[model samples]
Target chain A: MVRGMAFDTSRRQVVKGFACLGIGATLPLCCGGTWIQAVAAESFTLTEIVDGVHVFTGANELMNEANHGAICNLGIVIGDDAVAVIDSGGSIVEAGAFLAAIRGITDKPIRYLVNTHMHPDHIFGNAVFRDAGATLIGHRNLPRALAARGEFYLRSYRNQIGATLMKGVEIIAPTMLITDRQELDLGGRKIELRAWKPAHTDNDLTVFDPATQTLFAGDLVFLEHLPTLDGSLLGWLGQMDELAAIKAAHVVPGHGTAPASWPQALQPQRHYFEALARDLRKAIEDGTPLAEAVGTAASSARSDWQLFDEYNERNATAAYAELEWE
Target chain B: MKAVRQDRRPMAGTASKMAAALALAACICAMPSLAYSQAANAPSEKIWNELKTDVFEDRTIQSDTGLIRIEAPKRAQDAALVPVDIFIDPAKFPGGIKSLTLIVDVNPSPVAATFQFGENSGVTHLSTRLRVDDYSYLRAIAETANGELHMAQTYVKASGGCSAPAVKNQDEANRTMGQMKLRQFAEQDSQTGKGRELQLMIRHPNNSGLQKDPLTQYFIPPHFIHKLSVSQDDRPILSMEGGISISEDPNFRFDYTPDGNGEIRVEAVDTDGKVFRDQWPLEAAGL
Candidate 1:
């Protein structure tokens, strides 16, 4: 019922904006893209990328809108008999909302919850699935990842978000740990879980759905958004090559809109990484200080990406430090 | 010091006769008080009363000259893990204190860690990482000279250290474990040339039990370094037992009197039983 109200309000706002824009149609279009060209105006909220595969492009405000930097797009993939949720949001509340969305689609129980990496924003919602009797799955390094920072997260969540909302949130380790690749069939739907090594994170898992010809690429691919490289710049760039090789019809990134093709979405991140690696290597060879390298590296890549002004410098600094010894 | 004495006088009256003995029993039987009375007032009060009975009741902690000294952040920017430094006065307990214990009264596990230092250890100065559940007073108790416990305390603001993810990738972080670096800050001038401050950086995940896997939609298991040993010229100087409060890739600074030319060795053991060791060469400098 509340959803209907929200949709009605949003429709009215869209109509009002269109009415005002019609009066300014005579003015030379100041914006680069047409109203039709703007992806935000397309009204693509949550949609099924394929059969039983739903992707919620979290509200832009909920995503890369503020201090909470963009890392990955959260996703949910439901199989025939049971649902396999991918990349739980940053908090239990967010995860609960995602679970509710899943319930709205089907009555299938969430049997498997897979984490692509150990970043806090992606995994802080594990407790919600564990409470619902879903078996958590991730790479072998995930247990160590959570164990290292679990208590601290619980305390922080209680302090920042309030303990009541986070009640019964348990930091449960993944029951199933994948080493290289693991394949599971949820009824007739085949899901392939592949652990890509030393990319994005120490252990990054990419879920490929054969039935839908769709690949749920975690942080490995960022479409129309800045990519955060917590792993080696060189390693992530190499992984991008492997991801591009995957012939999937649709690619769901950890963040941003669903990619129509792998090359379009994955190539930019690879290019950014390549650019970062090249600059960092040159700086190291020249014995340039880290601070100086940051400016030179970011300025070089500024024109290539959209959110370069926001994260390029930091990315350059991280890339420099990461590749310095290598 | 005098105020601590005055505060005990009223307790003495409550323990004078039959009522005193009963009160003493209640105090000993009850639990130590929970530190945060501001947030969870009712429950924390209950927990505090329970703790007051279970621990810290009728217990007299002597503040000797230098038995135990606790150093912690006056205001922490992050609450998950806070660095805590403990120094035992050499004069007060000459036989090299046996064990040191930390009690963060409000944390989920109040007894953070207990370390048993060897006899060869000189002027015990141990630093460890810990998780502070809230803004609370942290107590460091040392077993000393007369086989009695001496304690010192300092208040630390709330920090979310545990929830904070390790900055680097898991593999990159793994490759750098056991790598130790010592940075010496500018020393202050003193006539005797006694104290020198040095910052030590040790790379370890120090995972607290609160973070989740980004893609899996599940919680990551908790694993953290539990013990640290520092030695100079192959001789033990300090050893620390850690808890969830230790920050990831712990950076700690301590003041010490260096002995001429010696190499410092540091060994750390994580809760997952992973051990790492590194060495740093000591350089002589004026304080």
Candidate 2:
């Protein structure tokens, strides 16, 4: 499901109203003056963590009009020769702001545009960079996954976010596929990209920057937001275990705030998915029907995450059916 | 007709006006189900009367809810392929089941399919997948040989059954349309006390006439399995007339008697008038 709002509806309403004021007050300022700088500053905010590495933190939230469709965490890695962008935001507007933010920091050409996965929140900004001559990069399964569900995702978003918000939302397939692992030299720094098994999704990839020691672990690590399951739960747990051993100083998650210890950032999600798998297996063993399993499985994790009501039951149903066959 | 508005109010005119009309009809078909919405958990007499009058044509129905058991996901993962299973025990019924009708209360063609079983059909068990078009109740009705219709229902949350895009290769789908394969499972039926459960799989695109071909950007004309029949030695035992709601690579399961030492024949005909027939013996097909 395409989520369009961040956490807490009351706060979102307030934020939406303030955003309206900010845009409205600047209408007159847009008459070819210092509006470009003012509009850029007010439209989106980016935090420069260290040199050549910047991140835009979308409210740990949903995808909607007020948020400018930036509901996921995206990052940029700049090297001496070129820059590699890790996941653009939900729409072209967000992508344009992201490109502007990159241009403000550096004049280097963007060489690599890596999508963590095919979720609309993370990968809908491909055309903006494609036209800018950035080669789209993704996991091996990304192109197929995009082809299979891309139109459905677009149609659903058009129905939900309105056509105006999705004026340039094109399902751009990745030209380069990272089969196992690929490394790119951004000037002196080298960024490592790995295509994963069917974990978070069939097309999940992680971008690891050794210079910064920051693992851009896309949807693989959800900090506070609930872990939405779209792929194999068993595979996801396996990936969590494998990723825990790799030492990284700090991590940038796809959706939430990541901490220094990247492995610790993954515990709650690992627990949630493990809980789902265990409960589903138990239900399957007991011959408890799908509806009943959906009603009861993983209820304990409901309070720990946002949008648990929307996604967990479906997660349980999918997990139950998969485990039932096995 | 209730009311035709200027530019057809709720939905936009993005799709072809004709396509939009069909889709609107699909949405409007969901209204009667909403009347049963608030009291959804309880089976209403009015709902049954409407179904009988419209689909069953004033046929008297008996309330034997527990006699029929339907299995389906409460919220389907894919709107186009919602798997369902219906089971009816002869011991529970006064007489054996003769006909079964599967209905999605919100689909454009709400009567998704109807299956008429012969006396040789053994136990009344059927399993298949359907396109659910919208969030509405799915009814699996079993009519006993004595002409008593019993119903089992589950509320499914899904949509786009009649119009979901076909993501498979169209050329490949066309090349392999109407191919049918039968797999027999070793499960005994209570009614015949001598047969096993049989499953038949048909490969067809079942284009809804609503989906656009990705390459051409033109609406793919509706081509689906218009008729499917199963027989023992050419004696028709069970048959189904499907529409756009039937999924591609459609799968179905039923009960059959294997005591006749005769071959089980399957015939599937597509909307394009192409007919495919396959048969298998109690043991194997090649032998």
Candidate 3:
């Protein structure tokens, strides 16, 4: 009861402070000053990957209040008449900050908002883009994924990032779903969106700008970060070659360093995935139980990735659950 | 929390301790969220105290008898796939164990399952995965042939923040529902002498249906395996009456003394009255 009361008190302060920040809005005498510092802290820089493609490389960390839930990469592809943004971000505050950054660069109408997948980190900010009148685009499976997990995401992330940062976050499903492939032309710049077959997730969608040959490989291409498996492990391993064959000069991965050279950037993750699969297969063949096998399942790749300790065992557990059926 | 952990009687034998250590280390590696760390400090026994009366009906359950031992991660790695192990000492139960009831105190469906063992069935070890919705006590209550109830319990910190106890691939689960797979291994139990181990996996969504469709605002209809039984040579080994607390693709692994080289058989029925049955020739011991 005490804990609940404490949480509610803090949440009320946040709401009160938020209302005071809007222009011409009444500043209540009870409003706390924490919201002022929080709002002022909302800013992130976007790196121009090419002439028309800009990538806002998020910090290589998990979603947290400190990071303001901006842990996954967000992209901005500009054109003469319109713009297409890749991934909304992890929280409403981060998305609001991202919108402000885009407005600084161009006044062009934000035409298309693309979601890479249904992970909370990538789609929590969907409301910001939807409110901006951008037509949301995602893989055909996105709606179902969101329907199944959207409420869970909201409840869970509120606990992770706190109510202050999650102020206006909402799970806005995409209206324009791509079943196979779709092309969006922002004036003369041509952007190709291809939905993959359940690689990193069931609804993974990649945004490729042919003009600059830059590929926005959502969570499908994790570099420094260990790849978390929520979909089929076999499906992801089987599609590695096809993903590498995408003709792109550079790639903006969902996490870690941005604009990495094509194909080569995937080698490290490929080795990690293969190594994990081999270990899990051996464990299964030896009749090792999931609880015992997962401890050392992917220990061989422990030195190769960031957050390996945090995500490896979970990946092993999920992978073991999948492979044991085979 | 400390008092409750300290209250647990020390598990006898090196094998049980080793198994407990391994399970703990694996669970520690799987704790991804820092949110649960704070929860460990605020232990709640209120739910368990209130739940016991409705479950056991005023029957006294002995906790210090050392007849049963239950093992689960202090913090679940995945809410949907929390592995749990229960070991019953054959030496303590001269009449053999009769039934085992598993309860996850905080889950929407608190009573996860109840398993009834066949007469003379040398079943001493059982392991299965469960879905823990929140920080709760996972207890295993065992009833011996003499009608004595002995219990062991462990607190599991759920991965509540991001991971819901929901199916990962709903489409894949639906497509493969009712499929069954079995694996066999040889075991030499110090107490039961020689025995055979069997791992049975059944494909089922085991949906709790507690979740509302955020779009439609309607509860997803609950569907899950409600009944399952396993036997060897026409002799019952174990059977369960389960609930949605079981993970998707329900799985069970256990050690039982093989009477003969008869075929091992399994039959499972879901809430929809769909029956799935399969059998495999019992592999020789020490394979």
Candidate 4:
């Protein structure tokens, strides 16, 4: 039998540490003069993509298996009066850490918490900000997405990890809903929120920071890695072109490192989707079996992109089926 | 003996004649019933027999001394593709190992992948993105210092991972492949410089065979990363073997002895032969 006893000490330490962190109590030893240093050490490091707008990359610390995409970049838009958080992150603890990071940088209250989509990793932390009085904002489909999967996420979190971290995490519904587009002013700073239909999800909202010429293009653009498909591939490809037309100086992807040019950042995703859609269409026309179509289409894309080898066939297959149905 | 002798006598002859008649009557009586049962129970019996054979089979796994360590979820929230990690203990196999194999008994194809490590490659660790066909035993057999296979097995609850969607977005997900991110969790306590954890995230679609392409009305093909390597300062620390059980955007954590300095590098090779590499510089905190 495999020895389970060897991991006990480490497991105990994790449980104890989690218990302390879960209650939000400062560790006693670190609470003295050393505590100040710890807090200073814990300060959220912000890398400025442009003046006034910052990307709060979560501490490269915390080995989270979830939220792998934006593990580093949590795009923060600081307005003159208040700050708007683009994605809330994976959990209440993470959101709390994010809020603390925000507090360290500026005293401005979080005026709005805009959700890019309904993915749990992006929206699970909504309750933390909502409890802190930030107005939750999202697309019209947000509520439905949350309602469908929120309980599942909660159960998974509690069952897989532990309940302490997710305790009291209420799924807060977005108070402000946008169907197509909406504009908001944060103390004279104009922020445009647009609902991109059936792209990444049923409804994906992108926040444009006009002053900084930065667009928080949620999952619309994943820099470097493979994109996960939830919505229509064709729709996403078209949206990418539209996003390229926006002419933003910087694009903060829902995941990956921030890109200096919005168009360049979105190109990889565009090429992938276009190629997938094109190949799938041809396969459907040729009457290629679904399995063969996936293999053939993915193999073709494999030579150009490294990540494609992992997901291309699957993407093609899914795109083919979705398109076939449509 | 007396009973046998008596039964064998003429008294038994009359009994035998009656027995023959009875036997004929019994065959006549049972033939239709036997045919009816065969027709009724064959399909159910086949399923039962398969289950019975699988349950009774002796599945024994042997491990090479230090070549591989299998890490499975203590409890998996989603049964479909439970995240699994395989690490090669460098100290145990100093000559630097080659080739890692994963055999998941419940899966349709038990042999997930066989990886050939590169030269001078601290390619001791691999993490793939995989699929688990069912709740069954999983084995990792590593060829070690002496060219013998060392094995380890862990029981994983199987969910229908093959059909899970690659992600919510087909296009955006396609763009993110080969992009790698490394995150270091909070430092250990100052008193104990032990117990450091690093999380590595790789972007991939991790397509399992079960998802229906909404457009084509067909099953998406299964493609996933079969191997991963995590190294520190050019030294091997963890190697992973992955299958369909690995979720999309596969993320994993590795615990290691801290030198308190050196860059941690992660390189992943997917089933389709795409390679991605990323590195993170270690920060020296007193802890």
Candidate 5:
């Protein structure tokens, strides 16, 4: 059921109607041309890392009105005939801007819109791609994850990022599911998609461009941004070796700078995970309550990462719940 | 009472809790409901005011009585799993508390869980995780053997907890459902003879029933551990009537005086009528 190719004419027309309504005054001069892309590229720049691959590194900040919820890395791969997108960004505004940026690069029909996980920061712009006739692709478990958390994300993020930006946002589940591994061909170029065990998230999927030796390690290999765990701690720590084993010359992490050197970029997160686990294990062994232990569980790694104060205790809380079962 | 097995239906207390949940659900569906209006203020006095009558039914509740204390994060990192600690001082009521009720006032089902303590169980402190749906009061109401209620509460600033969805690994969660484990801790030297601590972990989804299936356009029915009883040497220690507010993979850690010999037993029942039982030989009291 790859609904992405269905091309819902009515919805696209409605979306077009809304877009025109936003900038109706200037439509006569630049209505159907590259006006949108020209405007989009003015604010959002997609840096070309390799030959045809471009990366847009978002701000290292939480999703707020100021950032427009563009807090995750987004990628675009241009091929001979079609193009492939890594993520949709965090809002309709972000996604629209991203699609315009892609249009700025190439008019190739976006053959696939790949979601790395179920986090809103990565997939909120899906509706825009769905309108662009790009087939949505994700992990097999992604639909279930989206179904479960989609409403909550919509409701909660409205408060975090404000309602004006949340308008027209829809939680669109992927139709093409990658159970284990799948190679998507954008005309002549082939990109690999691999779904991993529950690590940073249960439905984590990574994209690798073989031609460029670049891996889009979605939230799996965070650098500067503190990794938030919505999945199993033990599962994540257990699979670090396997994740690091992926032979990628450069990596585009979900929340960090683009083109990070592979395997080496994993060190900081690995250290943070080990520190948090060590502290939590000691606390559990010592009979210290979760409420008391999480206050200082990963304090050793606090100064190393950004947003440590905002997410460390929360990560410690999640880790404590998972580790206590071990 | 060794190896006692009771197939209990929803008891009166459980039924009222369900009623409270249904009433709260109705209140939420009604336009401009209390749940929505209370979100602006952290310590929503209106929600607690309405929830008190629904849960306790006009009973006099004494707050800040020094008998019980509830601790929770001021702003939860993860709304789906907020750690809550409830400590009870036995000296305040030497007769012992008959039961304790946990309530998250702004949650869809405010009566999170109610536990009935066994006679001489020596249980004084209870710690568990809850899904706080909004910025609301997390309350622990302890009923003395004489039926007097003493309350302690803290305001937790969190939202979207009850409807935060089930575990991320849904397949693994289902596969491991109903599995139980109990970890025993050596007696603390400071609280000698007060009893050792035990952490009981059970694998259950404990879904809040608020998540809607996008394909079906209806809520996935709530599935959770509704009845749980833990005992030592077949003597009752504590039992609980729980609801969806309990986190996935329900866990409870508490201090209990273990009998010198025999095994510790646990039996839990979910909404689907699945029964799971496990027991472990009690270790030496101090070793």
Candidate 6:
């Protein structure tokens, strides 16, 4: 008990520093200046994807505090009158850097903050935007998903990345929900938001910009990174087919480089899903149990994707459960 | 952090080698200590005999292989909710099954559940989820109508599931705690007959009195479903006496023959003496 003083002290600091800069859960005068500087000094770089559409592509690394919780793709879309930020980074410091990045580019007031899904890396930085008075937007099922999974994700991530980096990691839920499809005008520019059937997650919302012919296809479209199946494998396979018909020129996926063509960028992920389905069918046909099916299903596609070893087995387990009845 | 890591690497490498050498010395010195621990850890054969006698008092135990088969994952991905399938061949048991009992030997409360088949019921198969706290031997004892008892046992490897974080926050879990949902698996409610599979999802934190609440840092109270009973219309189907080994939001899928498309009802009592009930329509739920 006495030996864990450092960890316990840090945990206390983390709980104390939970809310965003000077806003929610304000700290006392003692460590105020140092804490604010520590938060403000965290740096992040962004790439201008297109005219008025800037994106901060995350490092192709796992969750770690050194990256200041910027481990997912985040972007800002500047409309005529207001600015809309998409997918805030993973922590409070990242959220501060995100706000700074927006300030560096433009002084437009942020009106909307859109979250792609319920993943913590994409949603934990919501407090910064909320403090900026941006109305939060997410899929209809996002609230329930947050309710069902929010606390667990928070605690587990704190354990994984340590509490200091997770200080500002609070669940800032969506105020507005996208059911099927809705069109939002960020002034003159129109971005179409579509919430699909339980594909990437039970609540997966994608943002499409008609001006640049660009689709911010959240985790629905994966590039070099492996596709993760947290929702239905059958549903994801079907959703891919629906996404293919939507013609767009540029696709800014949730991870990796922006795809040159819209739905065509989904080819690798489509192949991964197809491989998973085909092998799972054979496993089910042969009465292969879940343990064996995990190893054999989609084993051939291991070399083609990143983090395949980390997720393939789990994906196979889900696929086996679904395909056994089929 | 980087400086600390860099400074420690060489020391760690040397420490491991020195530790290996010291381990050889320590093993010789700690022989008696190790033997004493082994004796303390191993449960006596008398305790095993006593537990069996306590659970199956005065009942004759016969070894009849292949009559009942228990299927569970060798390595559970989620220890909190490990799916266990029990299949008893009705053809092998011409006497018909009278009751079925599930037990996870290592759990604080070993008797996970008990199912009593209604009259004219030919239930040879059933499945349910369990929260296994540690690596343990699980048993499924089936009692035939003729008073013969047969048991099937398997060892499962799993850990940390009982204390893993609950799916939702404390407030949400408390508010939704006693809510239940029922659905038919293989057979739809409209065309239910014999050999139809049905699933029952019960909403309960099923706190094992082990996991600490994040905010309070105290063990959530040991309030869990202690007993559950299911009936179709007026006729009884099955009953269970659950334990801490039952997962949060305890769920079950089993074969039950429907008696003319009747509404299925379920009644459960928790450890705190709170009774919860829910029912499915004559038609399937959410139909």
Q: For model 4, state the Cα shift of residue B159 in Å.
A: 8.0
Worst 10 residues of 6 chain A by lDDT: A1-10
lDDT value, residue B35 of candidate 2: 42
Report, to 2 decimal places, the DockQ of model 1.
0.15
lDDT of 5 by residue, A130-246 (tens): 878889999999998887777667767777787767766778899999999999878777889999999888899999887767889988888899888888788888999998899
Among the numbered candidates, top TM-score falls to 5
Predicted structure 5: clash tally:
0
Ten residues in sequence with the least summed lDDT for candidate 1 chain A = A1-10
The candidate maximizing DockQ is 5
- Residue A144 of model 2: what lDDT? 62
- Evaluation by DockQ, superior candidate among 4 and 6: 6
lDDT of each: 0.59, 0.66, 0.77, 0.57, 0.77, 0.66
Candidate 6 lDDT, B46-83, residue by residue in tens: 33354577689978866546788898877664455567
Please compute DockQ, using alpha carbons, for every candidate against the native two-chain complex. 0.15, 0.08, 0.24, 0.04, 0.43, 0.05
lDDT of 4 by residue, A75-189 (tens): 6767778888887776555565666656656788888999888765677667667766789999887765555334435544444334544544556668899998898877767
DockQ result, candidate 4: 0.04
Report the C-alpha lDDT of model 2 over A1-326, residue by residue, as the tens digit. Answer: 11221122232211121123344343222211223211222456556554556777766666766665687888888888999999877877677677766776678999999999888888777777886789999988777656545655666566545566676777887889998999988877888999888767767899987766778899888877777666667778877778887667678887777433666888888889878888888885654545566778989888888868666766675566445434
| lDDT of candidate 6 at residue A116, scale 0 to 100 | 95
Off by over 4 Å in 2: A1-43, B1-287
What does candidate 6 score on TM? 0.60
Ten contiguous residues with the weakest lDDT in model 4 chain A: A11-20
Tens-place lDDT per residue, model 1, B62-164, is 6644678988766543343355778777766767677777777665445566666556445456665565666666777787645676878787766332224
**RMSD (Å) of each candidate, 1 decimal:** 14.3, 11.9, 12.4, 24.9, 7.2, 17.5
What's the TM-score of each model vs. the native? Answer: 0.53, 0.64, 0.85, 0.48, 0.87, 0.60
lDDT per residue (tens digit) for residues A79-186 in model 6:
888888889878777777677667777888999999999887788788778878899999987876675446446655665566787775677679899999998888
Candidate number that wins on TM-score, 4 or 6: 6
